[model samples]
Target: MRRSPWATLAVLAFAQFIVVLDVTIVNVALPDIQTDLHFSAENLQWVISAYTLLFGGFLLLGGRMADLLGSRRVFVIGLALFGAMSLLAGLATSPGMLIGARAVQGLGGALLSPAALSILTVTFPHGRQRNIAMGVWGGLAGLGGTLGVVAGGLLVDSLDWRWVFFVNVPIVAVITVITPVFVRHVAAARAGDRAFDAAGAALGTTGLLAVVYGVVRAEPAGWSSPEVIGFLAAGVILLAAFVRVEARAKAPLVPLGLFRSRALSTSSIALGLNGAAFLSMFFLTSLYLQQVRGDSALAAGVHFLPMGGAAIAAAVLSTPLIQRFGTQRVQLGGAALGVAGLFLLMTADAHGGYATALLPGLLLFGTGIIGVGVPAQISAVVDVQRHEAGAASGVVTAFYQVGGALGLAIVTTLSLSRTNAAVAEGASHQQSLVDGFHRGLLIAAIVAAVNIAVTLASPQLTPDAELIAEAAAVA
Candidate 1:
């Protein structure tokens, strides 16, 4: 079948939406999932962290697999695996089973996300057509995230939390059936690319996993536990070894040269900051809406509707903005919006109404993030060769996940610490929680502010550049 590029993009974007949607949908269902499955509070966090941890850990390897094997083939495999795991999660009889299923879902997401983005990179020609494709891609990614909460609330209210996972089954099945008819595979153009680097794969995956584990524990372990220190130390050492291995390998899992590209380097670092701010904003605000404002899951999700709309609008607008003012200006503009949004959130109180309080802040935060994010996404993968598109896509995606995870962990800890201090000072629990949330918002504002400086200082991007430089440091 000779499918048009737009049709191919539609398939890819839908798949990407499904993966992104899963990231947040589960948060609303955690209480239900835990109650039904009898998860300990300690283990309940894993329902969310399991997916994020595994997804971040395996993203680099997954991207490499697409490059060496075939993006289309890997895409199908990933979709099927994700669908199967979704079913398993829906049917799980215990916490361990559900958590394990979510872990596999993470693996599937890591594979398909990079594969889909890489396919888009190869399919669309650079400039206007590519810009449109990337815009749609970025828009839907944000849309998926914003809508996940709403959809989760609806599902949990009307049906059951289990339906959240089961809903993916039909969507996956339809996409899987139509994929090969539209998405074509491109062969790697490099010599000796067929050889696999087993050693590199092990080191990279394990190292990333170790670091994510350490960060995840730092919130609970107070960042000073011997186990957390040990894991962080091991992850760093292993990553260092992975770099040496990449430098020496006949076929590096991640080419050392991709990091040489200035556009990718700047876009990637800024994306990490954007990811930290964007993701943590959602987490903290959701807690505020639920705990402080006393809104139900459904109500909290409904409140985000305006933010979702603004985010999509910003994403669509970014393409023109980027084409007009260039990447740096659009990114800075977006970062400014983020800082303003977070700063506004600092004024949010337990008694503050949604219309005058959280709504305006969310609108700005959501709009600003997509404004920053869409351009950074386009910049990250642009100018890379067809052979390395998957790797490039993977690098950008991994940074978002890793950055979001670390940011969430650090800010959650800050919030918790503040909440504890306020309680010791005899404040009401609700007020203490809000105070903690404000502190986290302040830190997030600072992060957004830093992104402006980073954007200002980045090296000029060459139109001919390839791979990612800063990403090599991340890996």
Candidate 2:
């Protein structure tokens, strides 16, 4: 199963693009989906939530499965499942059926996402080549959300909303067929550790599921509601227990030792902040465009185009920056750009237009965000052992997912609260909407600012630094 690494990266990166793409593509198609499928207003949110929740919930488990079962095997199975679920989701006759299919699709995504990264890390090793591969992968991932909205709009307009789901079918079909032939990587790198830890898996998975569920429900149900409080409490306790179990397990589902690496742990925290700031910025900005500026969904999506372009450019330049300067310095510079971008976004007025209000901030934010993700991701896998690569990937991915959930909950609550307060004070509805948006975007900016400090204090290492260290040790 030997193959070219570049060929392997293309296959893996495309699979990842679809997974990230599905996250937002469905949002544009939601109204169409609801109208045709007779979805009630309340249950409509599940169309997106079900996939994200399950996908986030099972990431660790999926990563472990890749280690236990083998990346290639899990990859093929996950790809097939994802493709079939997409077909089922597209052809769904009822809301319940579509939700069910999406839930399964989430599991498939959970499996595939990490396995792809696991294979990439193992295939490329960690160096200049890895950075370029990651640059390509990260660029697609960052753009996927923006493209999803644009693509979803086009799909729903030119074709049907079902095409959003249907589009993934042929892509995965091609990848799945050529995967065994082209993705020459074999079983988990940790081939000798055959032991399983069922207890850790149950506790950790359920803990994460409960936490994500609580955050998702918090905005709609109120954070203080019994349901939210109960879920959050249970999640905290379950995760605590899971940690205890992992500490004692001879074969820990997630090796507690992995966190001992300053690089991995710091990157995990940094990435969580990255997700909170960046993902919520997208959510809030979309609302600003549609609610404040009165753009159509398609038009609102079009506004992200400039940001997407800046991001692609930044992603391309970042690898060489990492090669010369190291990940920590690059990440710090990105944070500064991101903070400046967020601050600029805060100045957006209720009466401002696209060129006057959003374009500047969006361009700055987009450029900075590419800087945010690329280095942290590169840092995350630094010195990670081969066998546990999947699990490491899962850990960082899960943090980002949960961070997004938390960020959305925080900003949305702040926005609504601010808007309500403004309305009570007799502000016009439009003014209140603007006030609320600024409040949320400001909070996102603050989060990005905090990351600058985090990146500055964390471990600093790059491919060249490692070589220097090795040479020094040999000398």
Worst 10 residues of 2 by lDDT: 466-475
Candidate 1: tens digits of C-alpha lDDT, residues 75-116: 888999999999999999998899899989999998898778
Model 1: ten consecutive residues of lowest lDDT: 465-474
Q: Quick one: RMSD of model 2?
A: 4.6
The clash count of every prediction, one per candidate, is 4, 0
Best by TM-score: 1
User: What would the TM-scores of all predictions be?
Assistant: 0.85, 0.82
**Cα lDDT tens digits for candidate 2, 418-447:** 887898999999899889888988899888
RMSD of each: 4.4, 4.6
